[model samples]
Structures are given as structure tokens and as C-alpha cells.
Target: MLLLLLGYDAINWFDGRFSLPTPGMLAAPCEFIDVVVTERAAVTGDQSAVAITFAAPDGSPLPAWSAGAHIDVTLPSGTVRQYSLCGDPTDQSSYRIAVRLIQDGRGGSAEVHSALTVGTEFQVARPRNAFPLAVGGYNQTTSAVRLIAGGIGVTPILPMLDMLDRTATPWSMIYCGRTRDSLAFLSELARFGDRVTIHEDATYGPASAEELLGDLTVSSAVYTCGPPPMIDALRAALVDRPDVEFHYERFSLAPVVDGREFDLRFASSGEVVRVAADQTALSAILGARPDATYSCQQGFCRSCAVRVLDGAPEHRSTALSPGELDAGYFLPCVSRSEGCLTIDM
Candidate 1:
């Protein structure tokens, strides 16, 4: 139970609780430290999912985490990416996370797939949870729980399966991927007996959220994580069940925005750049200073968030709420300005 307060906030790991707030997040930014990779291996036949175990550089026991917790790893390309902890929460010796390479992703996945190896070390932030199991505040009883995942989204739900089974709490899972080969941890998920149902897009019939969640009881809680399109469909399908709490983790950004051309003025650099209708503020900023810090160019990751000194922005990111927008913070990756804007680069 190592509870430490490195700054204004504390990462309390006592009693199985840990909190590491990131910048552009609601809470203040917390400390991030270095960790070494103990092992790295491809778990799937297609070699798309790479499972890597991380431990303290000095071989000290890492912090304890519960299901649905994720760690931010600084990839080799200097891109910070968040991955779900798919291994056992009871294992305090080390932390394990699976990375699924996205063919078209913005280099983070590619770096994780190719660069990470045994004996390699990288910086990782403490675990954080935007999604949690049916615990104290969830209001979900132990009677029944439903978990759903789309494609690589299954990473987060993997640990929940073990947690539910340990408590003897009845639960089920719906995993949907493009093809059978693309599904990671199928053998691990198969041990759940009839509790897990997988849907492959290559098959004539794909998994249907309506069919699986249509009969869900009002008392049940549904946890899902996936791309924006799949999540949007699930959200729309389950709209009628307001009593059912739908917790989700989105990996990618929302659909593209129909933005209008605008001007972005760097307050310190005295440089004004034009953002075309099809261009993003990040692209314009990068053109000005190629060495600018950024990752997950999709608005989902808050790495590109900057202080807005002036002008109203056409907020397209789900990461920032109305209060955050009013607080002079914005994600330049997908967020645009109304006409003219000034930012702190």
C-alpha cells in the first residue's frame, strides 16, 4: 500500500485504489515514472495483439489496480498511448497490457508493435479509471452484468471477466471483431463457457447489439468500449433503456468535422496561420513548428490540448466539457475556431 503525493494530488494505491490525473483532464496532472518491460510476445495468430508486461525498474512491486484500469505508456516514437490492463489485478509484481496494432492509426500502434521488446524501458503513468465495474457508485447489483466490446476494444473488458467470476457474479460478454483471426484472447475468453459470444464481420451474420442487449433488464449495467461508429450504434440501440447504465471507453476520435477556415495566432511566436476548412488546428500548428508535442491526433487523446487565450472554438472533442471550454482549455487536434483564435503553443 504505497500511497504517495508527488504534487498537489496524490496517487493513493492503498485499498486497491489509484488515481493519476492527466493534463487537459478534469483533475490536475499527476506524476509519470519509468518502467521496464519484462516480456513481450504476440498472443494472436495474426500477430496483431502484442502483450507486454511491465515492472518497476528496480524490481519493486507496482501499485495494485482493479478491473477497467488503464496505464499510459510512452511509446518509442515519443507518443503517449493508453492501454487497458488485461492481466490479473491480483498480480502486483507486474502489470500486463495488450496492444493491437491499428493499420491506419497515427503511428502509436505501429511503434508499440515493432519497437517494444524484452529489457526495454519506457515511462508509464499510474493507472486511471474512466470505466469501472459495478462498484460503490455504479448502483449495479451483483445479480447480472453485461459487457460488450468491438474489435480491439475487448482489451479493457478482459479483466472484468475475471473480477466477475471471482465474486461469483453472473455476467456475459459480446465480442465483435472483423474476423476470427482478428480476435485476440479468444482461448482465454473461451474458458468462460457459454458466457461469451463472439461475432466476426467476415461471417455472413455479425454480432447484433440489438439482439444481445435488447432483452437486458433495467437493473443490469452494460460496459462497452470500441470505435466511435460501433459505440454510436450501440448507444442509439440502447437509448430506450435509460435505467441501464452504459459505460464506454472510446479509443478513436469522433467522425470528421465540417469545419470552416479560420486563423490561429500563436500568442508567443507572433505567428498567425490559416486553418483551411478541411484542415485541423494541429496540422496548422505542426506546419509552424514541426517539433510540437502531440499524440493521438484524433481528439480522443488530450495530448494536443492547449490554453486558449482568445476567440470561441468550434469544440468537436468529447474529452472537454462545457466547464473546461470556459476554463480556457481546448484540444487543438480536432477543435477549430469560429473565425480568429489565439492559443498558447
Candidate 2:
């Protein structure tokens, strides 16, 4: 199966063929309800686990989500961040997610840690799932499922593990992090007994991807999410196991490339902004239009994607595929222009 990004949506491109959502299918209404943070605690030494409750101001049930689903949170500072739902999918009263503070990050995690508290009111985009679990393992030929997660990537996997356990599916997990103290959901995962393996970098150093995945047979299916390096290593190790279906989700941004200064012409605003070699097009665009809609400034989310009207674009983000570029879309958060460019804004 091939995955392609066209604008902000992910299209399942299989065997050089795919179907686009029709106008009616793409026009579902969404509600951004004001949710109150009901509980907040440190799940790990460094990660803060938060639970937010949502209900209609007039008392009605909020939207529901599946395992591996995430919601876009608008922070107190107006910075948008996406967090995977780690709590019970059956609980319609609340949603839980873990946030790890990134000291060098663009202030989203920091704002989440400092500003969010019990009783604090916040707004979030309804849950959306880009990484969904294949119910009962999509590979009918396989009965074994392998789940792998690294660092904070374990958030989404928690729900999958829960569903699998309840269904009595044959599955196992490999969880890795810098240290035991940095890992979350330890006590819960412990219930799975020997089926789960934890690897700490400080104690065990790095776990061999090949060794961890070597036992998987052609009739096995694997799902994993983590930093790009770990994902790349796992993919390389399992390259020979094409018969075993692989599902992955990556939230980290691609490395930024050195870019030259370029002129950004906004067709809608009739404004011209200069993007410097050391700066991002987002910074320039947001500086001029503070009301600009954007999220996940690291280029993980396609919230800042725009249509290119002219000139060549130096696409630095992993958000868009080759097909998306050919369709004239570019992510301004991390991507820059090869030369002068005009944007639809």
C-alpha cells in the first residue's frame, strides 16, 4: 500500500490507483468544544499526562475516536499541537494524552506544561485518525502482530495494546526509551507479562532492530512509531520481510535544508514578504498575518500547507509527497522557495 499527501489530507494510494473524497464526503462539520482539564500528573519523570473532559455547554456527549487517534490542541499561547489519545476509547466523558516537554522545541510542549492545569479551559479540534489500527490484523494470512514504540511514541500504541489484549489477539510489543524513568504506562504494560519487552538506552544501550524483528515470520504484521532515526533503522532491518505488512506513523519533522533568500508574494493580500536564509516562510507569513492558520510548526501536521501559484519551491517537509508537489501545494512551516514564489495564501 502507498500513502500520498494531497494538501492537508492523506490519501491511500494503492497500486498506482486511488480515489479522492468527493465534495460531499469532504465537507463533514466539526465542533471545537471548550474542554476543561480534569486531571494532570506526571506519568513519567519528564512526561505530563493530562485528561480533558468535553461536553456540550448544554450537556451532550462529545465526539468519539478510535485507538491511534489524535486531536489538535490549541494551546494557551495559540500554538497548535497534536497529541495521541492514550486513554480508554470507550470513555466518552474524557480524553487523555501525554505531553513531553521539549526544551529546544518551538514552545508548544512548554506551554502545555506551564499553562495547562486542572480546571483550565481549552479548545481542541475533534479527534482525527491518520494512524488507525487494522481491526483483527488486516493481513488475513497472519495471526501474529508486532507493536513497537520508542520514547513518547508509545502513546498511540497504548490504545492498540488495550484493544488487542481485550480481543485476546496474539501480539507482543517492544518499548524503548532513554531510560526506565523516561517511559510512561509502565504499570499498565506490566499486566501483559513477558509479552512486552522494555529496552533502556542508559542501561541496555541500543537494542538491535534486526534482533528484535528477526523472529517475525512472513505471516506477521508490524506497527511502529518513533523518531525518524529509529523508524529508519527498523524499516531497513525489516526490508527483507516484505511479506509481513508494515504500518507506521512519524510525527517528527524532516531535517531542514539550507535555503536562499526569496520573495513571498501573497496573491490574496497583495503583500510581499522577504524570507531570509536563516528564517522560515512561516515566520515571515505569520509576522505579517498574525491570524494565519497553522499548526505543528515542525512540519509534522499539514496545517500550514499552502498552494503555490508561481516559482519553484524548495520543499523541505516530509508532509507532502511528489504528487502533492506536482499539484502545486507546499508546506510553509518548514519548506522554502528555491527562488521568488507566489502563494495563494
Candidate 3:
């Protein structure tokens, strides 16, 4: 027994404890609190133009965050919505979020317009960022940065503009809206003079993608946030220039009319499900098992990520990096399997 243990057992014991390093622990989700609205203000003449403030207990500042971070607000109706942090990051007395009522929205904004009042208490999520400013070496060069905003998509760009202003970095902004009366932050944008350009669709046709985005150089970066049509147009216009960094955020999901049906197999659970053309990969998974947990099903959130064991996945989500995708990880929310896929579950 001692001789046998000295051979294979010794190698196995050493490999178990000392051969490989322990994997790093996963990051824990941030916590948020329910705060009462202290003040409300209407910046624009429109009644929908509203500003709400939330304060932490003892009147101390909330957690420090970088520019371009957005806080998730749970309205009185229990609807979760994300609003960009419009207040200065350095000033932490309270968090500020500006909201405009979307008449066509599916009850979220409508609830805020009718139900939210001063002194109302609602749950709020800590600031999370999808859009972070490129700094250091990325900012040292005098590369042209263009920001295109449609309607409320201008929220995130506000803080970005503040950063650019402080750094004295040259940047340009093109804001498009149906009319001046409907647009928010008009006064603030007007102060930027020629650096900011406004295009009202009522007077002139919406800005053309090709015309607005002329020839692109390798040093240019274009950030766009808007409706599907605006994003599609920008993507089409810049499809030829792959070198230029194009960052965009869509407020709503794009309509998916054409997708092939596929099969998804979970290796760990030994479960398999067929996904239809009309059903998203996430929808199929959650339908098969109601216990599935996910946040931000639009692919912006990395909550529903799983490891791909076999087959290639058509990467559609924005959460994972290119290297991560190459390593067989995918977000089932907006992504689908190109063929039959086996996931670790």
C-alpha cells in the first residue's frame, strides 16, 4: 500500500492542491436604497420635463461614480427603468435624474408622469455604466469625437460633454428632434455655440447618415444613441469603415422578422430546448424553465451569460468582449446559436 501510494497517489495529491491556481471570485452586484424624492423641478415649459433628487440617509453623498453612469429607478408602479446620472459626479449630496414622459412608452414613463410626486419613496439601483469615457492614451491624441443623439438619448452624452469640456478636447454634437419645443436641455446645448448643431425634423428633413458622417479617418470615434432607425442609418453609413470605432445604444429592441430555428442543449442540466424563429434564445430558455434569472434582457446586462461548450454562437449581445466570445461565452438574451449549441448552463 505504501509503494502504491508513492506512485500514482502522490502525483494525484500534488496535482489536486498545488498544480493549478484557484479561480478568482465573481464580482458581487451593487446594492441600492429606496429614497424619498426631496425636490422636483420642470426645466422646460413642457410638463414632462421633470427633475427628481434622491438622498442617502444622514444626508451624506451617495457612492462615488464616474461620468456616463446611469441609475436604475424603480417607479411607484414597480417598473424598473434606467436614467442617466445628470448631476456632477464630484457632488454627492444627492443623485439627480431627469425624465421626459414618453407618450408611446409601455406604461413605464406614463407611470412616472402620473404617479411620481415630490416626497414619493421608490427603490433605486446603484449607478452602472455601459458607456465609459476613453481616457489616457485613448484621449491623448487629437482624434475627432462625434456624438449623435436622438430625443432622450442625449442624457448619457451630457456627462460626456462635461468631461470633454474639462479636458479641453475638441468634440462635436448633433442633436435631432421632432421640434424645439419637444427637445430637453435646449438652453444648455445652445450655450455651446457652433460646437452643437440641432436638426429639427419639422423644419428640415432629418439629418442624412451619409451626409452627416462623411469620410471617416482612423482616428475618429462616433458615439450614437437613439431610436432604431437612427442607429440603423448610422450603421449602414459607416459600414464601410471598420477601423472607426462606432458605439451606439438603442433605447428599444429592433424588430426581428427573420431568424432560423435552432436547438440549445445545456450540458450541466442535461436539458434541451428548440428555439423558434420568432422566439429569442433567452425567451426560449426562460420559457422552458421559469426559474431562469436575468436582468436587462436587451443584452446590455451581463446577467444571463453562459458558457458555450459546442457549436458557434451568433454573437449579438453587447455585454461580452470579443475575446470572451472567442472563448465560448455568450449572452443568451440577444444572441443565438448559429447551429446546434451545447451550453454549460
Candidate 4:
């Protein structure tokens, strides 16, 4: 059966054939693919939108993806950033990503916003997902779904709302931005009637995290995506409620200089790196061995993740939930060694 499957995949690749994965194959993992940006446009004041078109080597559709899956785009400056697919997953023609230029960022968004143009080629890892929509339970019977987005965090939620509308699922969205003019998809979100709420910090007082989520019940599931300050605030405000499923995405890395010095021991390589108060474990590793691989040094990508064999990791990545952190996985890119730590590397 394994030989048959391998032969079939080979034939499909060469013949330009594509289909959904079988149940057995689905249980196995999928490989990443390369995609190219065929078109680009400036969508908002500081956001530029790009449409990436991918195909099999023989011009067939690539594997289908789910709604929340995101692809990592290797920018012109070699910085890899993950952007959620805003296009319909059912559509195989192309995938679209909207990037907001960050004035003070480490240059990934700026390079994408300024340099990338039509016909630019870049490699994309296959869609990997950490935030998938809840299917049954409260997600199914709930009369309404509330989506909270902060700034550029709206990209992933856009397609989710479309999918809900297509299924005639009742949902509402609250988009928070610094100002009315800075919000992306403002006009489109407004068309959803009172179901869509826009909060501008410049005009209305900043959206109160406690006030906004205070009334959440077991019947409702809340999805949030934004920077650390907002997510941290919301998490703290809603810490008492374990009944409500809170899903969120963060784009920022953990602070490296906040914690005290800690020792890190790599089991596989028998290497010990002391994480200084001013340096992260990843930085220490890369400083000693410059060939270490990493992307999105923000901890959003799992590229720099190492298995924690023992001791606690001061996990600071928004990529992993509390459950995953408890399971002993650590993203060394942004996470610091809380104390003496041993990792499988």
C-alpha cells in the first residue's frame, strides 16, 4: 500500500493531477510548496495587498487548504513572514495576503510594502495552521459569533466571516483600530449592519478589554488577533472563564531583555548557552553558531522551536496556547529560559 501510494503521488505530480488527500494521507503530514506573487495593490493607507498564484509543476491546482491556514512568504530581503490566506480556501486560482507597513518593525513588513511588486517570485511554506475555527459545540449552536480584531489582525478573520455568511451562520465583528482611517476593510465590514462594530481609539476611548469581554458566556466563542498589549489585556481580563473558547493570534515577539540570566542546555549537541538578561536563547545560539536557522524571530513561526526535556520555559510567544506550553514545547526564538533548562534541540 505504501508503494502504491508513492507511485500514485509520483504519477499525479507528473500528470498534473490534483485531489484531496485520502484519510490515511491526511493523518500523515503535508509538505511545503513555493508560490509566486503575480499582482500587487495598495489597499489602505499603509497596507499593500498582494495576490500569490501557486500551481503544481505541471499546472494543476495545489492541495486545498482550510480557512485559517497561513503561508509564509519569503520577502525580497529574505525575511519570512506568515500571512493568513484571505481568499476563499475553495478557490484554487490564487491566494491573497494584505500586509500593513510597520513604521518601527524589524523591516519584514516594510520590505514587503515597499519593494515587492508584480511578477516577484518567492518561496512559501505549505499552509500550516494553529488557529482553526471550532466546528461543533458552542460554535455550531451559538446564535452569534463575535470576532475581535486589532489593526492588521483583521486579515485572518475576513475570510472566516465570509465562510460564516456562506453557511448562513449568525456572526458579528468588532474591529478596533487606532483611527477610522487606519482600519483596513472598514467599508466592507460596515456593510454587515450593526453586526459590525468599529472602535477607533483616537475618537472613542480605547476599547476596554474588561468591558468588551466581561459579558462573554459559554454559548459564545470569541476570536481575537492583535498585538501583545491588547491580547495580554484580554487574556488577563478573561482569565477566570475557562468555559469560553478564546482563540487569538499575535504578531510580536517576546521581550528578551526583561528576564534575568538563565542557563540553557541542549541535550542533542551537548551545548550549554547562558541566556543573559540582554540576550535571548536564540540570539545566544546564533551568536555562537551563525548558521542556526530561524524565521519570523517573533516566535510566530515554529522554526526555532525546541523540545523542552525538563525545567520550565518562560514562554512568551502568542503562537502557542497555554495547553501547548504546558506540554513542554518552547519557541527559543522569543522565549527565554525561565531557570536552568534542558532541551532536546
Candidate 5:
């Protein structure tokens, strides 16, 4: 993604997308709510994915959400995990999200797959739409919106497809995965017919990110969710395609690049936490302060922003406003300091 710079004082858009917020953006709260698992099903034949539905115990309307919203689910083991709401946004009776068992990931997914069941009660933060779909005005340069998904990334795009269809908007999607068995919701995509394209790496090589770079192809507005390599390739290919309005949500936190070890000192407690080169300041501080609040491990959500007492922090998250940065705020999730940072905690 391209990074943009304003004047010397303003801290340019830090998402690296370097773009303005599109239509239908809404501020979301991080408040938690009580809910129970009303239904569960395996979307993938290989048992890799489990589609779970949650609703209020009394069946009251849940919080309203947009197409690309996600909720932070607190599992039985007290592990918090974020999952995109794939079900209809218009439905207030319940919210649906899917989880693909990630053996190599943190233990959250494993506990979800093993312990989450019908009638399971848990707390989930109200839906937060970090990837809101562009609704009202379509980009004039591009005629339609292109939806792209990779592997389990389809979770967010599913509600997008429904929203486009309901509004009678022109759009298409390309779903890529390692194989057919690994891709979730094939039967769901079948409803869209030829508008949806499936590329499995088992047969054809991985989908090329360059395919959408052509002027005649890929709508002017493109939204994609996928693993990093695919997302990175698309961003690199679109670097020169300035006419295209591109937005993406990554499946995981970005690895700290050119990272160096730093010490984080707490101003209130007078304690210190050593952040390794590969570790985020948020992760390192969480070990010492388990009560610290955070939602998206990615930097875009400002749930992890802290006030910097001292030191030069390399701000990497877009969530903090230029004014916030000027006020000595820092996002430890993605930002790193040159040497040591004293924070308010």
C-alpha cells in the first residue's frame, strides 16, 4: 500500500493505504455484550471451518452492524479472537461468524473449535466495522466494485456480496484458496453463479495479483481480504493504478519490519517491559499488565493506543489522528520507538 504525507505537522494516513475513508464509514464502540450460541455447522467438508451463530438469550435484537463488520469473541478459555460477521447485516435477531481451525496460531482458535457448541454462552464485543463497504457513490472512474477473497478471507466478503445484491449494484468476486476442500462456503457462492470466480492453487497456480491492474479489468473500487502475500502482491501491483479505489483488511497482524529491541517504561507503576525485535509493544506489555485492553492486534483499531510520556515513537498505525500523535499518543501494536519509551500506561 502507498503511504501519503501531509505537511510537517500532520501525521499522514498511517494505514499505508494512503486514501480517504470511503462512503458509509461509522464509528464503532468496543463494548461487550452477552450472547449464546444458537446454531453451529461445518462449512468445509474437511472440518476445517465451523460456522457459528449467536443471539441474545431472549432473542432480542442485537447491535446493528454494516457489511464488513467484525466482533471480538471471548471464548470459554478467556481468549479473545476476532471474527468477521458473514451473516446478513439486516438480521437483528442474531449474528453469524466463522472460524477456521488454525493449528499454528494462538490457542484461541483451537479452544473455539473444541469448546464452542450450541447453547454456549459467551461475551462478544459489539460489531466493529474496520472494513466498511462503500455504499452510496461508486467511483466514477471504475464502473463496478470488485470483491476478492483468499482462503478463509471470504468471511468478510460474504456480507458484502449480499449488500451489493440487495441494492442491485454491479459487482463481481474472485475467491482463491489452496484447494476446493479448504475453501469455505462454496455452496453459498453458488448462488451468485458466474459472477464469482474460484481459483484453487491445487490445479491452477495461485491467483495473480496483477490480473486486476489492467485499466479495463477490476472495477475502479476494489476491496479484498486475504493472507499477506496475496494482499501484498495486490498492493504492489496497484501502486501505479492511482485511478483504482482500493481497500483491504488483512487476515493477520503484519510482522514488524526492520524491528529492533526497545524498552518500555511505565510512568505510573515505574515498571519496565522489554519488547523483543519480533514482538509488538502491546504484546510485550500485556504480559506484565494482563488487564490491558485491546481488540484488533492490527494497528488500524486504536484499541491499543497509549499516551507516550517520552521518547521518539515511530507511529505506524492510522487509527491515531494527527492531533493525537501531536498530543503524544502512540499505538504500541504497530509503532516502535528508537530506543526506550516512557508511557502513561
Candidate 6:
């Protein structure tokens, strides 16, 4: 018995469950409703992607969400990640999200891929939509629409396609991926038929602006979700088509542009936070105030909006109105300071 205790029990050799116990599975807060992982399915042939479906524990209807909406998923490791809602928004009973394994990412995708079982429990914040369909109704506008998706970026665009098709809106889309097997949501996109274009980097060598835009010379509304490089190329291409209403959302943070290094003094604690030329003020300040809240790192959401107490703040966020910016409100996620600035965070 002692040898058995030392051999298989102490060392745990027979049933090797060497993995650590995760947090939030046994007892979660009352504030967050529990959603059990109801199903997990392979979404890509590469075995690097999965679609997870969750439902309320009590079979109650979940919160209603729209296309381009995302929810913050609190993982077992206490990591919070935002995933786009790829399922039909009208299906209020449950929600589905697809995740692609990013080996070089911050380990969130790897956790989702390896740890999320069908019966796993987790919490998800209420859905928030930052990038919404420009035209909700088909009869409201006559302008054409262009939807572009890159790789796993197709998650958010899937619901958009559903909404646009349901509303009878005229639109076309370009889905770019490294290979045909690497792309997710192909079955969903296939229903759209010739309206969808599949551009594989394996064959096309990467989509150029011209290939992406594809005779989009008219004054149309263009919506895109993809990697930063794809978004940047599309942005540069649209520089000439000023009439096109360009709305884009990417999974990654927007690169800080034209940032100047400066010191940020907090009004509450008088803590001087240094901002690097390439780092966002919000990113730098998080080291000091871990309790600070922010969403939509792209600056569309005003979750990180702080009041400027002193010094000059270069307002780069598109969220704040002219009156809001003039009234000392600034978004640190994208805004920077020219001089030593004081803010009431």
C-alpha cells in the first residue's frame, strides 16, 4: 500500500492529470451568468480552429446581440479575451464563437484550444458592438456595400453577411486566407454563392489593394475585419476613394501612430506615467493602475476616456465629440500627450 501510494498515487503515474486546476470553474461570481460549453466542433481542416457553442445553464434566453458584436470571455486561467459572435444574433438561446490557435499569441488562443471541453464552464460579458453594419435595412439606402474578411477575421463578418442577406441589401465580399483549408466559416459563406470571392494567399500570393477592392469605384460603404496589414492596405487604397464610407475592425490593437514620448501625471496619486513613442498611453498606464478599464483598444469605445486635468492632450480617438474633447475629456487608448500631462483616471 505504501509503495502503491508512492508509485501511482504520489507520483500520479497511472492516471496522469498533471495539469493545474483552473480558476472560476467551481464557483463564479453571482454577477456573471454561467454559460456551459454545450458543443465544440472543428471549423477548419488544419485542426487549428474550433467553434465553441455555449448556452445558459438554466436554458434561459441569453442576451440579444447584433452583427459585429463581441463578448469578453473570462477563461479559467483568469485571462479575459474578446471573441466575435459568429452565430446568428437572433438565436438568443445560445452563442457560438470560433477561435483560431495562434501559437505565437499571448497564449489565450492556445488555452481555448486545449482547455475548453464541452462541459467546461466560463463567464462571458454582455455583447458590445463597435463595428455595426452601416445600413441595417436594404431599402434605406441605394449605395452598394463591400465586405472584406481575412482569415479568422471571418467570424464577425459571417453575421454581417447573414444580416445583409436577410435585409436584401446588395453587397459583395472578399474572403482572404493562407489556404482553402485554413479558412473558417466557408460553409456559411458558401450560401452567398457568386457574391463571395475566395482569395487564398497560397495561390494569389497575398491580396493587393486592387484585388481586394475589385472595381469598387462607386460611392459605397465598405466594411472589413482582418489582420492589421490587410486593414492598412485597404486603408491606403481607399485614400483615393473619399466617397467610400470605410468602416473596419481588427482583432489586434491598432498600432500607435505619430506618438510622442511624454510623461503622464495622475491626479489621484500624482504618479508620473511615461509614454513611449510607440506605446499607447493606456498600455503604459495599465502597469500603474491595473484596475483601469478599457475596451475597443482601437479608440471607438470610450471605456478608457479620462478627464484631462492639466497639460495638452493630442486627441486622436474618433469616439469623443468635439464638445467632449473641448470639455477636457480624452481617450488614452489612442490619444497621446505632447508635454507632461495630468489626467484624472
lDDT of each: 0.71, 0.69, 0.66, 0.63, 0.75, 0.74
TM-score result, candidate 2: 0.75
Task: Kindly give the stretch of ten consecutive residues in candidate 5 with the minimal lDDT sum.
Answer: 6-15
Instruction: Compose the digit string of candidate 4's lDDT tens values, residues 91-160.
Output: 8767777777666666667677676666666665677666666544353655446688877778777778
Ordered by TM-score, highest first, the candidates read: 5, 6, 1, 2, 3, 4
- Show the colliding residue pairs in model 2: none
- 201-267: candidate 5 lDDT, tens digit per residue: 8999876876533333444567888787877888777777665677787776567788899999988
Model number with the top TM-score: 5
Which portions of model 4 miss their true places by more than 4 Å?
Answer: 1-32, 46-59, 136-143, 214-217, 255-260, 264-273, 277-279, 296-302, 305-331, 334-345
Q: After superposition, which runs of candidate 1 have C-alpha atoms over 4 Å from their true positions?
A: 1-30, 136-139, 212-214, 256-261, 268-271, 274-280, 296-303, 313-329, 334-337
lDDT of 6 by residue, 200-228 (tens): 99987998988888877456777888877
The weakest ten consecutive residues by lDDT in model 3 span 6-15
Worst 10 residues of 6 by lDDT: 4-13
**TM-score, structure 6 vs. true:** 0.80
**Per-structure clash totals for the candidates:** 0, 0, 0, 1, 0, 0
- At residue 23, candidate 4 shows an lDDT of 20
lDDT of 1 by residue, 220-337 (tens): 6678777666667777776766566677777664444678899999888879999998887887887996665555455544656777888888877677767777788887778887
Pairs with backbone N, CA or C atoms under 3 Å apart (clashes), candidate 6: none
lDDT of 4 at 302: 53
